[model samples]
Target: MTGFVVRRIGFYTFVAVVLAFFALPLLWLVTAPFTDTPTYEVKVPDFTPANFQAIVEHPYALGSLVNSIILAVGTAALVVLFASLAAYALSRVRLPGRDALLYALLLLSSIITGTAAMVPLFQLAVTVGLIDSQLGLILILTGGLLPAAIFMLKDFMDSTPKSYEESARVFGASPLQIVGHIVVPLVRPGLATIAVWALANVWGNFLMPYLLLSDVEKQPAAVIMYTLYTEGGQPNLRLLSTFGLLYSIPVVLMYLFVSKKYGFRFHGGIKR
Candidate 1:
């Protein structure tokens, strides 16, 4: 009885510490937007929307959010479309060095990150007349993400029954029709997963948009938020916290919506 009680107490204590660690930041995020002169400490907000007004007053604050949405939506659409097609092809076709090809692409993507290739990327963009263009940034981000997205989606594609495709083929459905009408329906979960994942990646991405876009008007929220600091480097915490809370809402809502739609629950994979 003594050991059992001791272990229970220790477990609850650890859980409580973990909960507090996460809860504090969430608490700040929720309360700071409505706060007057927000601070780092978690306290009851004074309940003013002045922080929001202050953010609204900033020239590019709201506009940056629009740009962010464009980038995120564009990138996610491109990634999901290309990744699904590539994954389906890789899953169905037996090719020499197929797995090797996928792994090689993934490995290269990880090693040569956007930051590492920024100079070359910028030069290429300039050569192609895509510098400071949203379409250019979307294409760049899509390329960086495609390898990993395809790799992840391939497992889902493989898990789908090939019998469906065979039946569709018997009906004289074209390859594109089979993919659109047959394969895509069976892999809805994979599509949803990758779409949400891509949105989150592009939404919070700062460095890519920062380097690609030069005009302040063209900048996304991630880049524009950096300018919230005073010239002396003192952060405008009120504006910063408010904008962060607003900035986080779209992705959080997207995750919740997708999870709810797909019934994102798991059963035990490892048995005791």
Candidate 2:
């Protein structure tokens, strides 16, 4: 009995330690922004708005947030639209070597990561007069994300009831109409999942935006956040913590809204 009680105590202690390990960073993030002089340590904040005032006065801080919104929304919209169509077609069609092709594309995308393909991507963008353009960045991000998005959405498409499509066809509904009305409604949860995924991916992305956009005004929050440092290479914890909280809000809000709406379940064709 003593040994069992000791084991139970040990387990609870370990769980508490693990929880504290993850919780401390979040605690710092919440408390530091309001501190008069924030630091690495999580101390009681002085509850000052000076940090936010400083960010508001900064030239590019708020504008960079707007740029991030534009990039994340545009890329997510394109990814959802294209991924849905491609996944639907792939699911419905019986083409030779289609599965092999999908797997090949997925493998290639994974192996040839963004870092490896940036040179070719940059040259292509330059050649096409897309350099320093937000649209170009969106297109590049969309292409890179499509393979995985399609692979995931394809499962949803497969799980969808084909009888609904056949019924629509019997009523003389065209393929596009059927897809727009029938398939889309059933797979909306999957679509929301893809949109959130893509948005988060593009929101936190820095490398592509940093390399593609040379103009300071055009850079997103991810890029602007990097400049929150002193000339001596020390991080300005005040502005950094404040901006970090503000930067995290939009995505968190989006996730909450989506989660409340659809519960983030992979229901596919099963109507909720």
The number of the candidate with the highest TM-score is: 2
Which 10 successive residues of model 1 have the least lDDT summed? 263-272
User: 29-112, model 2: which lDDT tens digit per residue?
Assistant: 999999999989999989999999999999999999999999999999999999999999999999999999899989998999
Q: Summarize candidate 1's per-residue lDDT along 61-130 as a digit string, tens digits.
A: 9999999999999999999999999999999999999999999999999999989999999999999988
In candidate 1, the residue pairs with backbone N, CA or C atoms under 3 Å apart (3 or more residues apart, or in different chains) clash, namely none
| lDDT (Cα) of model 1 | 0.90
Candidate 1, residue 32: Cα displacement in angstroms equals: 1.8
The TM-score measured for candidate 2 stands at: 0.97
The positional error of residue 184 in candidate 2, measured at the CA in angstroms, is: 0.7
CA lDDT of each prediction against the hidden true structure: 0.90, 0.94
Clashing pairs in 2: none
